[model samples]
Target chain A: MAQQEFDTTAFRNALGSFTTGVTIITATAPDGTPVGLTANSFNSVSLDPPMVLWSLAKTSLSVEAFNEAKHWNVHVLSQEQQDLSNTFASRGENKFAGIDLEEGLSDAPLIPDCSARFQCRNMVTHDGGDHLIYIGEVLNFDQQDLPPLVFQQGQYAMTARKPWEGVELSSEPKAPECSYNEDLLGYLLGRSHFQMLFRMRKVFDEQAHEDSHFFALSVLNIQANLSLEEINDYIEYTGHSLTDTDIEFLISQELIEKLDDETYQLTANGRETSLLHIAQAKAIEEELIRDLGQGDVMALKLLLKRLISKTDPGLPDLWKAKETAK
Target chain B: MAQQEFDTTAFRNALGSFTTGVTIITATAPDGTPVGLTANSFNSVSLDPPMVLWSLAKTSLSVEAFNEAKHWNVHVLSQEQQDLSNTFASRGENKFAGIDLEEGLSDAPLIPDCSARFQCRNMVTHDGGDHLIYIGEVLNFDQQDLPPLVFQQGQYAMTARKPWEGVELSSEPKAPECSYNEDLLGYLLGRSHFQMLFRMRKVFDEQAHEDSHFFALSVLNIQANLSLEEINDYIEYTGHSLTDTDIEFLISQELIEKLDDETYQLTANGRETSLLHIAQAKAIEEELIRDLGQGDVMALKLLLKRLISKTDPGLPDLWKAKETAK
Candidate 1:
């Protein structure tokens, strides 16, 4: 790791270990052309003087315009701006052609819907190896509630914030020798799934429906007019199969009707019940988004989807379009 | 937000929206006293020169020590070093009493087991409002595989890195008007849980055991001796209650034996089976840790625990200490 014999790729990889927020620094050229590029080098330098700093590669095409510009704006991008980040990161022409800009303290482009923004006047420029560091005094700044996008290890990321104190499931820690503990991924996933279902159980209990009956109704709601055997293929992974008695019970409750001796479809009452389940599930999710921040919930869903894809056992696709003839 | 009359709290909050990796900057005083403090303002400034910068409040107690020091070390804290971060953050005595220092290129007190470490020579100190910015030229640096600790919006956080492309569960985009999609948190959780269990089912199938029998055995393994009602109390949330028929089936398989025809305990074969399940679960988890990075899996577990705690329905604790007399 000698400074004189530094390996460029290794150094970049080591530097990438330090995570940073994504930002797009924008400046206006002498001809009134808006130039912007994605950078994660932005950092707050001072508070009382309201200063910030960011470095740019000397070889960048926008370097000359940025050097001549008197003012520039830093937009801390939100998670929703990944596409915009990619566009500005490349040598795309007319980057701001379709963008609607907001008025700011300077002539620099002010992009809307950012987590934070800093309008600054260039105060000084310092030599930093192959890059030039631009220090500025912030003239005005604003913030929004959107979650900032993060970059780490050369990939985009999102943060699942740990509370200041910490999140504890039990009042006391589990015994060390216990075979199963709260830390087990299996236990955590099962508990989360069942607890969510527990809330929906109250709704189903009103109609004297068991868990298997609910599963059957949910399947019918998606791909209608399916035989009992076909519906079971989609739910066999759940370890609960509907018996003939369970189908008969659902028919007795007016939740399903026989299209033929083998095929079945949801009745009007059954469709209403299934829709109620979906609505309740959405309501519970809304509460979660409120409890946990939207970004954390999004990360959770992303990881869960990945897990599902990795562990899938060749189950039939639940959302695939059914045959029109059927 | 005028710079002259800026509200300090709001400004600080706005700056915090720019996420950063946590670092502990350390240097030795004239009398050889080790001083360090947590700072999130660390950022890389150059690659060719291998330079980095961080700012410290001018009013800090270690200001004089740092000002006089010719060299300092920057430690990028890992997720496992949260306690060390807190200790250095406070004005505590003997912050380095128990820490094991690693030899570095400079005399700066280098801490061991950090995600990354940079031994730097103090290049320049710039006036930054009420703070002093230290720009250091790195002489040598090293990095580990540990996940870096993150700070965002005034709270500690962990990151779940998204792949370069993205995570898409389905092959095609879902219909806009569909009632249920892969985006549903409930559906994701259930699918994730069942899919994980589906893999474990292959192991269980070798023994001709059903999912409900496995659940019952899991409960019996923990509590040793339990009546059928007691076991059902723990397994009911799973929507699988143990019945007399289930107990008879287990007896027929020689997996369990009845004590006074009421209390039930696992036979030697049953204990072996339960232990095998635990090992299989752990192996599956290891594969997940490989597929999803360890940090992302950790974040998923944290979010799941929070979700379970929020939605808990007062189920009896399975790991509670049982009465020895009983």
Candidate 2:
């Protein structure tokens, strides 16, 4: 039988939904020539004594260099560093060409204009599918004052603060003029995944037993901008039941409006109703984060990262071993 | 202590370092009227039997309605639904005025045109700082294919794809036309909290010893776009080290250029140098994702979702009890 082929594009697209930053993993070849490649797969391993990890494909040109090199460097890029992300990402390019070079405390060529730079000795390497995972111990580092870059949806992008809350705190003296007066209210009203169980309790709420339409409305509202087919596909994924008549009923009521023949949007009335719930929801989130603190937050982040990586066809075996060990 | 007067701007900005989406949570008052507010602290909870949770201020007018209400609805707004999010989030002024509504399956008025919706019963509420966290058990849900509206930098926006992949897959059918391009690269490239430990590996590459200046150069490149004050702040936060001259040396090299002396961006040459090692770092990511099968993938997502909620402050004790049972 022909080898089972995987749809790389599908995998990429699915993973692309997750956002990450770009970094350059660098090591020296046996002959002392620097070898490196771009990566966004870097993450932290521990805080005490400071440890970090990144991955490298077994078939990559620099694989041998990474395997034998006793030390490595990871450069975190700034928001304005797309050119660097591109240069290192491309294969066979004179990665070092036209770039001025300087050495770090550990003797690696320091990346000019990076958001942050870390120097470390190769701690260990583990086997991941089609790649070798490298862990490092920190020796020294450099820092810069710049917004970090983010990668998502198959492109390099800048991170935006979610309106009123997430902007740089220092910029508060000059808060941007905001007209979206009810921003906080909207957050409280938006329905989230957990609401599924709540809809069930509505059975006890009514004078006459009725199936809750909150989910239905929210589903339709959520699916508003999608085409009918896309909406259906999403409905199928989320396991919602809506007859064509039900959809047409929503349309007739002017709760939803067609953006295009294929796409639809929520009417003004639709948004107000939805916003009512999302506000309360947000207050809950803030409470959780504040209560959890850093330890739980870090654990949560690590577990979530592992979960996302598992979805990809290319997970590391050692990580699996670690999980199994647990 | 005089209520511990706090700088609202400072507190708001400091917390903005974390990113989240905007949402609105709503519930019918005992009188059968609606109440709502906006928030960004919304997240998914249980996937099995789908559940979602959000928080509300304990002192808000909606608190009474929320406490008495047997069920509530959550609406996830789409990017275009910001107006809707705004409407339900506002105070008084008859939110229902000028709003269109469709009766939900449970006879509650459903907001039209949201990204998604969920109807659930109010299962539990917890006391949190200045807020009441409520967890709803989701019984019904809706989803759409539209991009969610993003609130970032005090503006309404849509998510832009991250960089580092090809725009198109094999010219096969069913592929979505990629909306991302280099022109939008500036919007995509930098919003990551790269682990300090991971960054250290890049700082101590063996090559850094060969060229002491390289590490400094890389750090300076990143700093070019940032103010000196900002750089110092970041270093303090991350515990990184560098001297004033190291910064000066980078400026002298012209590799890191300042834009209008207010912000800095890496020169093309600077980017090239930075990319040298980054490409190799991502190879492991590709490999790991490729190795995992679909089952492992699903399990990973579920586990992560559960773990993430565990850290949430808004989760009801009942739901947490259920999670522990698993």
Candidate 3:
């Protein structure tokens, strides 16, 4: 495989294109020491015999233990176990340090909180160049609904499921040619954002507050005693600016009070109003987390933050401003 | 390993938890016919020797062809290749029917437009219980910039890469406890949406058109001669509604004209205005695609559409309205 013209880096990059789930395979050494290493080479073999297989480098410190071990446990790690996967990936002295494992069907170590687990009996070992392929027969296994952690191109990743038929915004066919279609990213983002905000508007409308008023109050709730100009600086990116009359409206409602000629602060009532709005926002997000699995929500938030970061103007960070003041 | 009490279905389900990239392993038969099968069991074996391995069931129709073959090719599939993956997955005749393959170093068929491709010489074959593992030495390989297709839990999926440091909106620490943190999905959705909208506001401000005016014109642009009430019915979900004064303003500006006592339609100038705004939105999205990568933008759109679907407040379909009227 290694020719004089072979570019090792390119070959590695080519191989990395194959995505896989991160796994931690564990086994007990002859001296009863637990050894484990992170691998993405794990794959199922046959369903009729309940078989699976994984490969380990011959140079690995745990390869001898795995070769002699009659049983080993395969932990299909959940997204929550990224740190655990990292820990086992390195050749540390005690990869399983300070960790508790569940009792498996064999002497092999069992890592808990995995997406799935397979208690496998060693069936065969074969040479795979510099690695040894271990074929196993799973005697017992269990699984959790936890989302699995993914690895691709030498980096960790997360998967968003594409439903069998595909996800469509319009129940009807797409918008006609040469017009705004449902597939437009901008339209989808705007529609989703406003639809969600519609639910929170009920809370805002409870006190006859407007969208600009909500922005001003939420900012005041986080970073207190800001001048009208400073508050607008934080929110002007939203295409909504708090006007003098908007501030006056809040004062008239006793939701906010004038700190000085130039500054305003949320009154106790205003703070409560802001918190109510925040709570409603959280409730909506909670419902989303339930509707979209936690993993999908995490992915959504991550993608949103990335989009914001890439598109961010020089808007002041409200939370950071407060921290800086303190 | 298969105990009498072992539940084969559950074991299979557990095995499916490990996500994998789809691949098509192809080899030329003894009689020179091309044979291939879709598999997710393909994985890199060793970097030093540049080895890879995949498992095939002995019962597979093409198993003998693969076993006797001396060279093979593995194609790591891109998201666009899902149909091809499904095609080779079935045991149908002429699996490569009407297919054009790229020239390769080996006699094995080479598929184009995959995320990555590896041409390899047979290194060794190992026997497991019901399956045979083929280890190959990679003689040549190549990769493309396309995003790989993922398979997990019996469904097709797309992966969103997680940055090494993770994504955060604020450089400062998160909002303190007992308050709204930046992780709330609603706030993120709102901020991202408005920030994106802010870019288009420059175009709107030039025309002195408000958000509601833009919405009304866009509706009228698509479905002609909409009454004010009918137009508001569509934009109302956006937390914005056009008032009679707003429609009168559009008419005053000659952007729209009165079709009847209660109906309004966009003037040529009004349709052009809407089209300009849509073009600006698309331009912004194209910039995002360049910045965030097309795949990330796609994932964002998918997650947003799903969020919208779940949180939709029964807004009238703008595009669907036209079709129904026809």
Candidate 4:
């Protein structure tokens, strides 16, 4: 623990293990200069007194401005404000240039569309070694339903909350020796995906349509006139492929029709079916967001996208390959 | 923002919008008593001078103990430390009971298995209205790769990092008019599940087994002597069921055998094959853990489990239903 052994990079990295919400602290200095910087050190201090605190590096360019400012505003950035965070984090000229300011109790600049806003009067400053800690008495504050942007280990993040009671698919504890217990990631993904489709199965089942037909129509809804082979190339990952009999069935039902040159395209009836499926899918997701909260669903989708990309197996780009060619 | 209009609950809710990592600050009173409590106010202030700060309410039972202490330790809780957080958060007697303590450079009790630990010398203290803010100079620190626990909007959470460049399923932007775009949660979940299974298809394909056989054997691995109807009850959610022909095929391959009462059980060969599939599945998951980092994968699994529980359409518990009956 000697000073010589203090690897500053490693120390900073260790400190980064603490995750935080991104915030933009804004203040209007003397002589009418508006200044702001992005900081994640913000934390709530005293609820009774309604106070909050954050720190700034002593060597920051706006140190004097913050020190002399009578009031400051802390805006917890939303997920869509990453660019604003970057703009304020850097020494960009005119950090507040494009951002629309909302009027607040103090003269401090208030940026709109933050997850939360705290208008505070600068109360006291404390020495924090190479940084200065500013404790502020919160004059007024407001919050919105926007998902707050997160930072963890120097990377931006979103959170999926764990219910205090925990999520258990079964009311019973799984046997300790079972290898195929419920904790498997692959198993969970498969079940989650299938259960979702299982719900939508009712909608398609009522129309006497199999999942393969739904999958093909979905592909055709985006990229028209695909031969059976080309359509199979996209939906084969679902372990189902469209057969000629299935195509005949679709055509008889007027959901799809044969095109010249041996390709098939979705008819107006088919397009309507695909859109209905999409609407049903959207409804399911809306229900999920309502149940799990928007932030949790956004985090789930982000992770799913990342997982899909990481494990992509060179699947054909369903949109890019077809759209750009046209 | 008048005094009467300051709703304490609303103000606290606004403050909760900002996420933070859970921490437990520990110190020993001069009279040989150890004290610690759960906190989320910990934040790093200075990198060069190695300073950090956390605050405690003056009315807290341990506030005087902390104020009188000359040294303290900050342990950033990992995902596994949720129980520890709850333990410290409560007014339980003998908070350190049954917990192992690690030796540190100072008298403060150091906690083990945390995401990170900072041993610090209590340097300066400032009055923050109803709270006392303690700024400390970090003396020693260490970190592990454990996923840190998060607290957001009054719920415990885990973070999934968003890359600097966002995760895009396709190389190009999807057409605005396409209802079949990739952003749909159902689509993402389906694609991710299929792609992962697509990779595992190699292992099972080598044995000339289909995904349906794979799913059936998986259920049989957990519950023995299940009739086709009972087994289908467990796996029909996967949209693939074991047909009578498929069951006969498994019997011919010696992976399963028919019982006198029309139930089926995995033979020795079937058991071996199922175990291999489980191994391959675990290997695939390990690769994902490597690629997505441990935290992100954990978050994904947590969310998936939650979604599965939320959307469960009364699928029979593969383990519990049969085991309890047995």
lDDT of 4: 0.91
A best-first ranking of the candidates according to their TM-score comes to 4, 1, 3, 2
Instruction: Score residue A168 of candidate 4 by CA lDDT.
Output: 80
Top TM-score model: 4
Docking quality tier of model 3 = medium
Per-residue CA lDDT of model 1 for A256-314, tens digit only, reads 99995579999999999999998889899989999998988988998898788778778
The models' CA-based lDDT, in order, is 0.87, 0.48, 0.86, 0.91
TM-score of each model, in listed order: 0.95, 0.31, 0.93, 0.97
lDDT of 2 by residue, A129-176 (tens): 455656676566555645555554455544422333322212123312
Q: Please report, as a residue range, the 10-residue window in candidate 4 chain A with the lowest summed lDDT.
A: A317-326
Model 4, position B172, has a per-residue lDDT of 77
Error of 1 at A303 (Å): 0.7
lDDT (C-alpha) at residue B21 in model 3: 95
Per-candidate iRMS values, in order, are 1.4, 24.1, 1.8, 1.1
Ranking, lDDT, top scorer first? 4, 1, 3, 2
What range of 10 consecutive residues in model 3 chain A has the weakest lDDT sum? A317-326
Q: lDDT per residue, candidate 4, A1-326, as tens digits?
A: 45636789999899899999999999998979899999999999998788999999999999999999999999999998999999999997888887778888989999999999999999888887788889999999989999999999999999999998998876677756448888888899999999999989988998898889989999998788788999999999988899999999999999999987788998998889899999999899999999888999999999999999899888888886565353
Angstrom error of the Cα, residue A123, model 4: value is 0.7
- Please state every model's RMSD to the true fold in angstroms: 2.2, 32.6, 2.6, 1.7
